[model samples]
Target: MENSDVVIGVIFLSQTIFGFLGNSFLVYHYLMLYFVGCKLKFTDWILQHLIVANFLTLLCKGIPHTVSAFGLKDFLDDIGCKLIFYLHRIGRGVSISSTCFLSVFQAITISPKSSRWTQLKVKSPSYIASCVYMSWVLSFIVNIAFPMYMTARWYNRNITRLRVFEFCSSVQHDKTSDIVNAVFISIPDVLLVVLMLWSSGYMVCILYRHKQRMKHIHRSNFSFKSSAEFRATKIILLLVSTFVFFYTISCILQINMSLTHNPNSLWVNMASIVAACFPAVSPFLVISRSLCSACAGNRIS
Candidate 1:
């Protein structure tokens, strides 16, 4: 391998290992919590599912790229390519949907008791579970056409190529199928972005109002409820903001790759790296929050 390739391989391997470990830690932590009979909050359930999705995403996207970067060519066969790409897309979709659900659920949870949104809090757990199930079903159904189109070079002898890369390629779809696929992929992403923004904005407003109200109260008489809400809102905002940043960059890189018709370009590697950033970083944020919360709880006791 060239020096540049080696460098890329090292970076990719490091990211894959870090993301895998972080996500694994999150999954293990939550599973232990469950087995120990600790009652999981609604958001905790969403978080556990998100961790699994992110871990799968890292594995599916990162492993192949890392292998290729290390000079291992054609590491995956046609079926393997299709399966990895399909599962990666599903995992990405689930992560987006789960994060959106988490934000909306928290928004509802922190709403004023008199507000209509707050009334849904009682049913939030059921709503979250239903949303998670629907997201998985929709992702699986929509991406079924993926394996039909995807193949490694060995399997492409009889097919008209849509786009060719060193790693994998897909057959060109007809106009209708292409449009349908585009819409299918775009809808969930667009909806999640909208929901995340609205929920984040609403939470920000709520936090601002609470801060204003607190200015009139004595410091010693501050409300623990307000503090907890503030912490939750801050964490959610941070997570949403970071996700949007990385996701937008990744999307831009992907668009560049598609439009340029060069799947082997450095942009592809960059896009994978950018996409992996969120999964690698998000788990640490959750761990930090959990540790802080635990410390705070212990102090209070």
Candidate 2:
């Protein structure tokens, strides 16, 4: 393999390993908490599902890309291509949906009891469960065309114009079909982005109000629950902002690639790396936040 290929392989492999392990740790930790009879909070339930989605995304997307980068041409057959891409799409959808739900849930949770959002607080668990189920179903339905449109291809060093990965290529679709698929894939993402932005904004307003109120209260009268909620909201906000930043960059690069018909360009690779980085880094962020919160609680006590 070329030196560039080696470098790409190394980067892909590192991302895959780190992301897989981090997400796996989260899943294991949460499952253990459940088995030990600790009650899982609504946020924990959302996180557990999010970790699973991230883990699957890293595995399904990263492994194939890594193998291809390492010069394993035609490693995946047509069926393998379909399955991997389908799962990756599903995982991506679930990740977006779950994050949106988490943000909205927290927004409602922290809203004033007299606010209109308070009603959602009581039904939040049921809504979250239903949302999760619908996310899976929607993702599956949207990606069902993947297998029918994908085919495995052997890599040819002499061919310079083919921009797809060495292992698989998507069959060209009719213009109408292309438009329909694009719309279908984009609707959920657009809706999720809108929801995330709205929820985050609402939460920020709530936090600001709470902080103003806190200024009037004596330090000795501060509530630990409020402090914890503030910290958790901040973390979730950071997470959502990070996701939006990365997802936006990735989407722009992908759009550029599609327009230029150069999916093998370095920009495409960079997009993939940025997309993978969120899942890889998120688990560590959660773990660190949890540790810091625990330490703070102990110190306060």
Candidate 3:
């Protein structure tokens, strides 16, 4: 009933609604493209998975936070908490994996034919589905620890070792089990982040070299700016940078929370907002890029 709670609730509600609509629009647009038999780039498939994962993440992370912020409680049972937490983890995992894969795929796509990655570029599109499938499988299998530990939040409040959420609580595990689970979770995340950074750096280097070459060949700067490949690569770079920025902030907040023996709700809510930033903002970026591409095509024709 507090004004602060109302404001928080409205913020989360707005983010969830806008994110869902934007993602839905992209999904619909892609489906229409498929039905009309339009020629689609292989990267489009990776984006489809990303969009879906974003949608899932928004719903799972947003609705519960929104509801709790409004001071509603006890709506979720044990099963509900377990399912929501499990799905949210899976969605987050898939989102990270998909972004990493997309970055690597785009880097390969734009590599020169003479480069050592030429073989990978040629064979990569065929493996897109397999990679997506594996991401989903790995996400599901790795987060099984979540469901085992999650329970509906209890009002009795007798437990000291539980990690309490708005509607769910995680029972603390033994130190050994916790270490093992953390290792399994952290390793994949670290690998994906490293791959993303490497691929992004590679793309930046290629773009720089291309720009220098273009400077010698063309008097007008517009030639490089007007390129479709340039625009596409720019969009991917924007997405990667946005994701990394928000993900880093979220991780920092999480680490701060873990260092505190009893962190408050504000830190938790702030972390959730930071985590949701990329999902809420990324759809608009892609939509703008798509519109720009269409306009460029028309201009060329």
Q: Candidate 3, residues 1-301: lDDT per residue as tens digits?
A: 8888888888889999989988888888877776655656667778888898898789888999999999986788888888888888888999998989888988988888899999987788778668888999999999987798888877336478787766677777676787687787878988999999999999999999889887777566556434777668879999999999999998899778755545677887888888787888888999977832242222211
lDDT of 2 by residue, 1-301 (tens): 8988888789989999989887888777766665655655678778877887898789886787788888886888767878887888888899999889989888988999999877788898898889988998998998887667666665323334344655676666555776787787898899999999999999999999998998999999998877887888898898899889889988888777655543663665676687788888888888878822232222211
Question: Rank order by lDDT, top first?
Answer: 3, 1, 2
Q: Which stretches of candidate 2 lie over 4 Å from their true place?
A: 155-163, 174-176, 291-301
| Superposed Cα deviation of residue 262, candidate 1 (Å) | 2.9
List of clashing residue pairs for candidate 3: none
Minimum summed lDDT over a 10-residue window in model 2 is located at 292-301
- Write model 1 residue lDDT over 1-301, tens digit each, in one string: 7998889889989998988888888778766665655665667778877887898789887888899888886878988989988999888888888888888888988899988886688888788789889999988987787778788867778535557765887787666776687787788798888999899899899988888898899998987866776787788788889899998998888767755544664777898888888888898888878722332342211
Q: Provide the lDDT at 25 for model 3.
A: 88
Q: Report the error of model 3 at residue 149, Å.
A: 1.3
All candidates: CA RMSD (Å): 2.8, 3.7, 3.2
Clashes of 2: 0
lDDT of candidate model 2 versus the reference: 0.79
- Residue 116 in model 1: lDDT: 83
TM-score of 1: 0.91
